[model samples]
Target: MKITYRFLLFFFSCAAFFHPIKNAVAQENWPIKPITMIIPFPPGGVADTVGRPVADALSRSLGQPVIVENRAGAGGGIGMAAVAKAKPDGYTILLALSSISIIPEADKILGKPPSYSLSQLKPIARFTADPTVLVVRSDSPWQNYYQFIDAMRKSPGKYNFGSSGNYGTMHVPMEMLKASQKFFMVHIPYTGAGPAIVGLLGGQVDAVATGPSSIVQYIKAGRVRALAHWGEGRLASLPDVPSFKEMGVPIQFAQWAGLFVPAGTSDFITNKLREASKVASNDEKVRLIINTAGSPIQYLDAPEFKAYWDADAKQMEEAVKKIGKVE
Candidate 1:
């Protein structure tokens, strides 16, 4: 009986050892199948513009197709929540935007249960940082940034600015501007940047604070006029337009997009994904697409990205507190 019991114990110990070995081997093999990159915004939007190119580049580097799937709604909360709760096996990832950092504060201000916390997602890398530009229709009387500000200061709440959504990335920066400049403009929130741009063109709103990519072509076509860019310097595509720093606003805002995986994703997989991202960011086609969107390719690896995300989240939180709840 003793000998039989010892045999069983040895067999169980071997099973335990080999089971982990198998799992480790599988993890080393990593993504034996296709991976999904969830954009959390509708197709043809800024997120899609960056997400698709990165996905294609990742597909090439990773030896597997990296498919992009858009899941748009609730100002990007739904898709982020799904990724936060998704399996952390590296198959599912998020192509998150700067808005992801603000959603938590927005939820709190709105008195809603948070969809996902910043802690729920792990940063992989950041690919692009596109500055926000305040733009108006070509025919608008205001030709420069000061003119727009003077108009708003003179008639509080007479002008309105459209944004992708309430408490979104676009909305936050505009609110900061409003707070700093002590001006008032009625806020008109749309479902996404695409819709907000449409509202601006249709005369539903006086101006829109958006990434240049969404309106660069329109600006070139003389359909819209860019007043002030919210960055450290002017965009290469629109050099004549001055940055907010140059205008004495002392505020720099950019709609940066990055890659993230569920928080508990294994280090091996995260490192692999980061390496693939590094390769993708350097791809010539990827650079062209991002540059054409009027966004500079700013890639940061996992640690740097985490630090950047944390700082940005804190800044957004304070900005939201100052702006208060936006109904």
Candidate 2:
């Protein structure tokens, strides 16, 4: 009987001892297969634009192809929830917008079970935080920012705007404008920003308040007009555009893209990916793609990004509270 008990004790001891070694080996051999980076918004939006470049850069650094999948919906909730529940094996990651902070808070306000919690994800890096611009078709009657707001006030629900989703990054900023400035537009929600932009261009919707990455190309092509932005000063690239602060609109908002992994992912894997992100964001090709789109790279490592994420989440919650249960 003593021999059996000793045997059991020895077995347990070896099991504990080898468990970490097994994990270490697994983490070290990670990306033996391709890694997937999920962009919560569809193609052509800020998330996709930033995500693709980052993915390309990361693939070069990690020696494995980093594939991007667009899982767009629910103000990015569909993709965000998928990544949150994904195996914490580091093969899956989220490249989401600041809307990453909004969806869970919005679910609370809507009295629904949250699709996922902020605690379910860990920040990996922040790639870009660019000011949002308000745009209309170039031929639209409103010639300037002041004229645009004055028209919205006069027309109210007669005019319309489209957004990525109900409480999406794009929608929240417009809602902020509506609440703060005492105006209203018939709000139209699309599955993602790419579709929202399509709606705007097809004349299905009249305006879009969106990240410059999503619209600067269109502006340069003269397909859209940029009357005002949610910044205190003009963008270096779009000098002719006016800012909300300069116009006394009393509201400001910016769209940011950041990376996240599921909680409880092995620390080794997290650090590996984080290091890859640092290298990717600094790559000259990545920098040029982002800068040409009018959002210069604004990279932050994990710890600093978490600090920024926390504060932004708080601000989004407060603003949502004031807006309150938009139907």
Candidate 3:
């Protein structure tokens, strides 16, 4: 009986010791299977333009396929909410935009329950920063930023500006412009950047506020002419077009794309993802693809991304307060 008791105790002790070791090994071997990158916008949008390339790079680095899944709806809330509630195992990740920081505050302004809190996400890295540009049809009467502003001021509500959706990244920036400039134009909100740009091309809207990637092709094709970019300086691709600051608008905003995992994800997994993202961000092919999309490849690691995200969140919160609700 004594020998049997000793044997049982030893067995339990060994099992207890090995259990945590097994878990550690499992975590160390993270991403043994495929990973899914959730892009909260339709294909051909900024997220898709950046996410797909990053996903490809990650796949090569991790030795596993990283699939990009588009879950476009609710101005990016639906897809973001899904990632927020997903298991914190680093398998399911988010390729998020500036709207992720804006939508939560917009929801509060609209008196809706929060879809996802900033705390629910852990920023892995930031890959791109593309400034927003306001563009008009090439055939429009307004030839430059001054002309467009003058026309809008003279005829309030005569021109209409289209965006991705209500209270989205594109919408909020336009709202800020209106508030600052005291110009009035009908706000036209579309489902995503693709449709919003389509609206502009189809003559459904007077102008569109979007990232360079979404409309660079149209701008090059002479289908649309950029009036102003919301950046501190001119874009290399559109050097002649002045920035909002140059025009005395005092607006500088860019739609940044980054990788995120659910909150509470293990540090080990997060570090692994961060390392993989660093590799992907520096990949020559990935950089080429992102540059071709018209968004500069600006990489920030996890710690830096977290700080940037916090600052961006605060800025968006204040902007939302000034713009009030979309309705």
Candidate 4:
């Protein structure tokens, strides 16, 4: 009997000791299969512009494919909730925009159930962060930034703007400007930034506020003219353009793309992703693609990304409050 007891104790000790090693080994072998990167918004948006390149680079770095899946809905809530509820195994990840912070705040303001709280996910890295630009068709009657504003002020609701969706990053900025300037522009919500741009071009909407990357091609093509951006200074790619504040709009906002995993993701996998991401984001090919598209890489590590996210979220919360409940 004493021999039996000793043997059982030895067995339990061995099991305990092996468990951590087992986990470590598993983590090391993580992503043996493809990883799903949920972009929360659809293709052709700024997120897509950066995400596809990052996924390609990350795949090569990790020796595993990073598949991008667009799960856009509810102003980006559908995909976000899926990521929040995803297992913390690193296979399912999110590369979302600053709207990641706004959707939940909008839910709270609208008195709806929160889609996903900021606490539900962990930031891995920030790939690109660019202040949104306000663009209108080149053939429009308004020739400059002030002309557009004066027209809107003179004929409230006569003009309309397209957005990705309600309470989306695009929507929030335009609404904030409306609140600040005391003017009205009918909001036409679309499925994604790509569609919003189409709407703008097709005359479905008069203008749009979008990430620099989303509209750079149109601006260069002479289909749309950039009025101004929501930045402190001009973008290097758009050196001739001016910021909204420079035009006396008194507003600022940026759209950012960042990688995130469900909270409780093991640090081993998170760190691995971070390392791979650092390389992927800095990849020369990826840089060329995005930079030529208009936005330069604005990379931020996890800690710094979190600080940036926190500040943006706080501002979003207040912006939602200011916009009040929208039916």
Candidate 5:
């Protein structure tokens, strides 16, 4: 009987050594399958341009295919809703932009609020930051930020500005400016940034509020003049342009984009995704792509990014309450 008991103990000990239930090494082995990155905007836009780079980098890092699928419409709602409804498995993620929170505020203009709230998604990482720029045609009379404001103050509603869409993310800042300045200008909305830029280029609009990427080419060619960047300081790419704050305008807005998975994702999978995203953001290829897109790398880890988003959401809500809807 003693020999049999000793033999049983040895068998159990060997089984325990060979099979561990949970460990760091085991969790690192995640993403056993391909990942689907959903871009909540159409192709040839800012979001799509930035997403491809990170997707390629993630594919190389995880040794699995990372596909970017565009689901445009409803001002990023359709794709975002799809992501929120996807399985909580780490395989699916949404490239959330300022629009993720803006949509709710613009709801009155859109006719209703978004179907899914921020709570529906788990924050993964903040990948990039880009500021909006106030621009005008090269031959326009307004030479600088002050000249533009003086023109507005002297002849209210005489000038007009173009933005990506009606009651969209880019339009919100313009709304705030109009209210604070107590000036008037016809707001023309385009289907997207491309069309809005075309309006400015064709001399159809007096000025525009767009990002560096949309106006980089025109600004470089001297076809358009950058009056000011909507931030605390000048952009690295446009060193000479003054920031709105520096001019004592009290206006500054920067838009950011991040990654998120559907809520209810397991902690193990979420952590794995965060690790993979960090690796992808640092990849050399990703750096080149992001630089070309005109949005510099400003990656924020999970906790910090979440706080940023929360604050941004609160700010948007207040802006909406103050200005009401654009439509």
Candidate 6:
């Protein structure tokens, strides 16, 4: 009996050791094949800007060629929906933006509902966040947010403001501002933030509400003048620009980026991706890229990210209510 028990114990010990080793190997080789990172917006937008570097870093870390596929259309719904329907094999992920949370609300205003709910995807990590800025031509007459708001208040719907898309971060905040300030401004939605900046630069629009990533270059070139940032505080990149509150405007908003995999992906693979993202976000190269772009690399691990996202969504809903139903 004693000999039989000793043999059984040895067998169990070997199985426990080998099982973990085998699992680790399998997890490490997750993307043995090329992986796809989906950017829901067109190239040259914030999502693309942040995603490219991450893809490069992830490729090196995973030993696989990671590619960024631009699937821009339908206000980011088309690409996001693709992610929801993707196989949960840890090979595909969505570079989700703050706009992802508002798709359902925006759709409700349009009399249509989003095909896939936010719950269908698993949040991996919150990669970066950028404050929205209100910019105009450097040579234009408006000097500050108050002056701009005074003009808009007098003219109401006569002013024109350009944004990336209908439900984009830039659009939503501007709409809320108009409603709160009791003004009417015609909103022009471009395919992406790049085109919106181009429109502003070409004198096609009176002003633009965009992230610093797209407009910082022009600010540095003395081509565009920043009126105010829609953040609690000023952006480090444009220290001269004031916040909305400081400008006496009670509205604030920002754009955030995160990573997500399909809901059914294995927990181990998702954890691995999360760990890699954390490392990439903290890398010196990534920091330089974000700072040079005028946006900071803000990292929020799983739990913190969920809380932040939830509060943002709730605030958006309240803003939508106060701004009235928009289409």
**Clashing pairs counted in every model:** 0, 0, 0, 0, 0, 1
**Would you list the rank order by TM-score, best first?**
2, 4, 3, 1, 6, 5
lDDT of 4 by residue, 1-327 (tens): 357988999999999999999988889899799999998887899989999999999999989999999998887889999999999999999999998988888898889899788999999999988999889999999888888889999998899999999989889999988887888999999888988999999999999999989999999999999988889988997899899788787999989999999998999899999999999888999999999899899899999999999998999888888888877
Mind giving the per-residue lDDT tens digits that candidate 3 earns over 59-162?
99888899999999988889999999999988899998999998888888899999999899999999988789999999999999889999999999988988
> For candidate 6, lDDT tens digit of each residue in 37-119?
99988887788778888888888777788899989876688888899989998889999788888776777767777657778
Q: Taking the tens digit of each residue's C-alpha lDDT, what string does model 2 give over 1-327?
A: 357988989999999999999888878988788899999878989999899999998899888899999998888999999999999998899999998888888999999999999999999999999888999998899889778889889987999999998988779889998887889998999988899999999999999999998899999999999988888798987999988899787888879999999998978888989999999888999999999998999899999999999998998888888778976
- Quick one: best TM-score, which candidate? 2
Query: So what's the TM-score on candidate 3?
Result: 0.94
lDDT of candidate 1 at residue 235, scale 0 to 100 = 80
Off by over 4 Å in 1: 1-15
Better of 1 and 3 by TM-score: 3
Write down the TM-score of every candidate. 0.93, 0.95, 0.94, 0.94, 0.84, 0.89
User: What is the C-alpha lDDT profile of model 5 across 1-327, one tens digit per residue?
Assistant: 357988989999988876665444555677778889998766656676678888888888778889999876666777888989898867888886777887766675457856687788889898887778889999999898889988998998888998666655567778877887778888987655666778889999998877676577788899999988777787887889998788777766666779999998889888867888899889888887777656678898899998998998888777767767666
Question: What residue runs in model 5 are displaced by over 4 Å at the alpha carbon?
Answer: 1-33, 108-113
CA lDDT, every model vs. true structure: 0.89, 0.90, 0.90, 0.91, 0.79, 0.83
Please name the candidate that would achieve the greatest lDDT relative to the true structure: 4
CA deviation > 4 Å runs, candidate 6:
1-28, 322-327
- Candidate 5: C-alpha lDDT: 0.79
Could you report the Cα RMSD, in angstroms, for every candidate shown? 2.3, 1.9, 2.4, 2.3, 6.3, 6.0
Alpha-carbon error at 222 in model 3, in Å? 1.0
Candidate 3 has its poorest 10 consecutive residues by lDDT at: 287-296
Model 6 local distance difference test score: 0.83
The candidate with the higher TM-score, 3 or 5, is 3
